[model samples]
Target: MKVGAIVTRIIRQMVRDKRSLALLLFAPLLILTLTWLVLDQESSDLKIATIDVPDSIITTLNDQQINVIDIDKPKSALKNSEIDAIIETAGNSLRITIDDSEPTNSQAIMMKIQQALVSKANVQQVEINHLYGLELSTTFDYVGPVLIGYFAFFFVFLVGGISFLREKSQGTMERLFATPIKSWEIVAGYIIGFGLFAIIQSFIVVLFAVYALGVPLEGSFWNVVLITLLLALAALTLGTLLSTFAKNEFQMMQFIPVVVVPQAFFSGLFNLENAPLWVEWIGNFMPMYYGAEALKEIMIKGNSIDAVVLEIAALIGFSLVFFVLNLGTLAGYRK
Candidate 1:
């Protein structure tokens, strides 16, 4: 009887919380819908170039599911990323030069090209070459940068957001307002204060993942740290800003599926270019998209600061926008 009564009371409380009940019923469906909408599309075209190739080889490539584009210069095309890869024939030798920016795409390109060459029943002349990273680099290396950003953002957003959310619950915000603290001071204080801890956390996570955990680290440690820190900042600001709209801690967590998880799906965790058009456009709005792209360029493509400057700029822009929005939102507390 006691156990039955406890269960009955729990059920009554759950029914009273309509948002929680709706979320329990609808969050999963919403996630499934967004997932199907984004992932239930055909892949985008993969462009390959054939240079000085025999007619038989060209015919074979054309028959495959890839796009064969004419390139005036194969070397320049591979270097410029104009083509995914190039299959070239010189005398009796056939060689492939792959643009290995995204390691997963590189693997797909190689497998398909190899199968095409083998189907001809003559592949003695076939050879493989990579434009960047090691030929032996694994999928882990390719996704290492993204995982780093996601993990850092994941932990910090929860801790920082929840810590602030507690202020509202414990009447800390009201207490603070009774003092002389300006609204902007409250906002800036939280940001700058958490920022110090976030930087340390970013350094530790990046170093641990790269050195201790054996993730691929082709870029300078400093560059990886820089990108991860910016990602953390974006997470911190975004989480804090969104926390204002959440009435309680549970609502704060609801942001995970709505805000964070969607970004993970669209942030190069899968092939961004392969998703539906509207879904791919969503990637442009995600802060994680730029961070993941920057990490890939730095770690796999071996790009420098200049090459990834645009992504860094986007991250900073996200941080600034969120910070300003927080200020505006907090103005409600003042007025």
Candidate 2:
């Protein structure tokens, strides 16, 4: 009888927590729906630029669902990732130069091109060259930079949100409110306190990724660190802002499914080339997407800071917006 009462009480407690109930009931379904929306898209619509190629080859490529465009110079297109591969006639042989940053996509394009060339009896030899990534580069190498940024963002968000929630729950925030300290000052103090650790965390993760894991560092090490730090700051500010809506640590965790998971899907980890235009647009709002793009440009393409200044600006913008929101949320608590 006592055990039955205990079980009933626990069930009543769970039922009272509407957010927890909703998360349990709907989070998995939401994630699955997002996965379907992402993975259920059609195969990659690879674009290949051709120069002096026969009409038969172009026809074959089109039949394989690859877009074939004629270009006078393939170098610029390949460099910009505007086209996946460049095909041109070299005497009796064929020359194919591919952007190998995405090894999986590169391999798939090569396979399709080879299948198309198989039908051409006059084609003698096929010479393949890579524009960026090494010939031996694996899928991990392509995704490694993105993973580093994601981890840095994830940990900082989790820690910062929970820490700020602790300050509120422990009455520390109320004590601060009783003082002459401004809301913005309190927010800035918390940011500076947490941001120091975030910087250390970013450096450790980036260094480990490049040196221990052997992830290629094509650009300056400091550039990667700068991007990681900015991403962490964005995460930190966002976390503290969201914590204002949570009453406790468990409530803080509820934001993960609603906030963090969606960003992961849209953060360039998966190939969304064939997804709907709106699906791609969702990524533009995600800070991690810009961070991933910048990291890939520097780490894979060896591009300098000037090339990724726009992405850096986007990260800074996200941080500033979140910082302002934090200040606004704190206003309600001010005495």
Candidate 3:
């Protein structure tokens, strides 16, 4: 066929297949817009509640566009979330309460408050308490396990999805279908193979974060293993389910920007303190959020088994849902 005729034929085919065309062009845009709305929600200028403050400090804050809420009950202001941080200035000492959930914003607010205090006089070291940590902590200390969980989950998802797609394209899946074996049996076989590898991957990641990266490991090692294994199962189930939607390796890759990146943002790797409520709610739907939360609890907070059972339960529950969907998606192959 001539080049122009071939091109015309291709356009006709694409026009006829509206679903593929939309997946190629519009899905990314839709996801991008949602992510933008999630991340760009405007934060009110730092809300500061004070018991007593020098006129100089007050003027400096106003110049910085800080919303100063003069209040007697500093506790009530924080409890109500009316203020982002509190600065109680009594005598030469200043007591600061930083929410610490939004570490970046909280740090900025704390720094500005400190500078305001120093400008007033030779301030002795101020008493600072992070409502989250109660003491100074490293960012890696906070997010290291999360990063580990994410990297492990991301790689496993991609690998499993692409491998399953390969099986479909190579006719291997069809060959197996011709046999007496059941659809769920095929899924179970893949799981048994991938599950062992996933366990190894989780172990290496956890060990690297703890020993090499110096990430804290305060909880029971067994709890960490249990959570990681469950998280790996979730990734494996999601990968297999998504493979049914992807016709090829390239299409399998297309799932990442839509399915994977959002999890990272809402997975507690980045603080979602100021994120839109809808976006934050979306996190509750993603398996990574629970996995990372469980990891953080075990690694950083040193939470006990009782503390993380719900997170573990939720992760397992999500995996089971995906597993059922994975089986249902294979039903078309059944005789």
TM-score for each model? 0.65, 0.65, 0.64
Candidate 1, residue 331: Cα displacement in angstroms equals: 0.7
- Sort by lDDT, best first: 2, 1, 3
Q: Superposing all C-alpha atoms, what RMSD in Å does each candidate have to the true structure? A: 13.2, 13.3, 12.7
Model 2: worst 10 consecutive residues (lDDT sum): 24-33
- Pairs in steric clash, model 2: none
lDDT of 2 by residue, 1-335 (tens): 33343335434543675664344333433433344344333336788998888888899889877888766667898999888899888987778999999666787787788867766677765554568746323455667788778777877788778867887999988886786667777667667766666667677777777776666789999999999999989998999999999999999999998988888787778989999999999999999999999999998889999999999999999999999989988896673
Candidate number with greatest lDDT: 2
Per-residue lDDT over 1-335 for candidate 1, one digit per residue giving the tens place of the 0 to 100 score: 33343335434544675664444333333433344344333334778888788888788887877788887886897888877888878788887888898665687787778767867877574555567627433455556678778767776677667666777788988877787667777767677756766777677777766666466677688998899889889988998898888889999989998898888886677875666799888888989999999988887777888999999999999999999998898888766
Tell me the spans in candidate 1 whose CA falls farther than 4 Å from its real position.
1-124
Off by over 4 Å in 3: 1-126, 130-136
Question: Clashing residue pairs in candidate 1, if any?
Answer: none
Q: Candidate 3 residues 16-107, lDDT tens each?
A: 76764444334433443343345433344778887676666778777766778777677876877767888768666767887777756686
Error of 2 at 265 (Å): 1.4
Q: Which parts of model 2 have CA positions greater than 4 angstroms off? A: 1-123
